[model samples]
Target: MNQKKTIILDLTGCKYFDELHERIRIAFDFPKGYGKNWDAFWDFMRTECDAEMVEIVGESTMPKEFLPQLELMHTVLSDLKIENAKYGWNFDYKIIS
Candidate 1:
């Protein structure tokens, strides 16, 4: 499945970037608790945001949004439902065929 793309919100003077980063980091790592669980992504956004600040992006399969919660690293990531199927790093290099 394709990963969900994110919308960048330029918080030029926002002072909550670090807190937001921690929140998102916890969520992404422990999706069930602090991460973007399928059941709770929209729920949290709806409750925690105003009507204009949050808008759902991406396809139905991977819906993302612009969260004005305050952070640069707290962007969207693809959801893999399986608990054990964690996302890992990628290493790519050019190889002429």
Candidate 2:
């Protein structure tokens, strides 16, 4: 049987963008020089990772000040899904509050 890979990123105590980025880089094992920015994030999600699904949890506990960043993450993932479909890659991303 083939099993799809699932990666979970728990962002429970992340209060800042940098902290969130660092945690994601470590959790996802991003490359040594992974750029910690939205653009780089999209690029990595689109090209580097090979997961069938990615789950981001604890968003409700994130600082209100980081809402924009959270929203951007969601948007980027949505865009990536659309782009992936066009290229015949099955990818899915989810945010959990």
Candidate 3:
């Protein structure tokens, strides 16, 4: 079976980590009261997410402070892919300008 690719991460006008998390929650249709943190992100992605590709927009324009979190997100997604290897599950992202 083939799943349609989805771009759930776009930081075009995002200027803060909280804003980014809200975008993520909205994009992924996360339920209310969702924890807007890395652990929450990892748990959701590992157990419930089905999006194949999460395109990250505005890489160049993101605030300097956002870079650290962005890198952490990349790491989390990468780790998610690895941990789900047993199920042959895959996740990927692309940074767009």
Measured by lDDT, the strongest candidate is 2
Off by over 4 Å in 3: 1-3
RMSD of each: 14.3, 1.1, 1.7
lDDT by candidate, in order shown:
0.31, 0.86, 0.79
Once model 2 is optimally superposed onto the true structure by TM-score, how far is the C-alpha of residue 65 displaced, in angstroms?
1.0
**11 in model 2: Cα distance from truth in Å?**
0.4
lDDT of 1 by residue, 1-97 (tens): 8443332333332244344343433433333354434235434443432222222221222213424331122232222122113443221111111
Candidate 2 residues 1-97, lDDT tens each? 9888888989997887888988888877898788999898888887788888889989899889988888888898889889889989888988766
TM-score of model 1 (CA atoms): 0.22
Model 2 residue 45 CA deviation in Å: 1.4
Least lDDT summed over 10 consecutive residues: which range in candidate 3? 2-11
Hey, what RMSD does candidate 3 come out at?
1.7
Candidate 2 lowest-lDDT run of ten: 88-97
> For candidate 3, what is the TM-score?
0.86
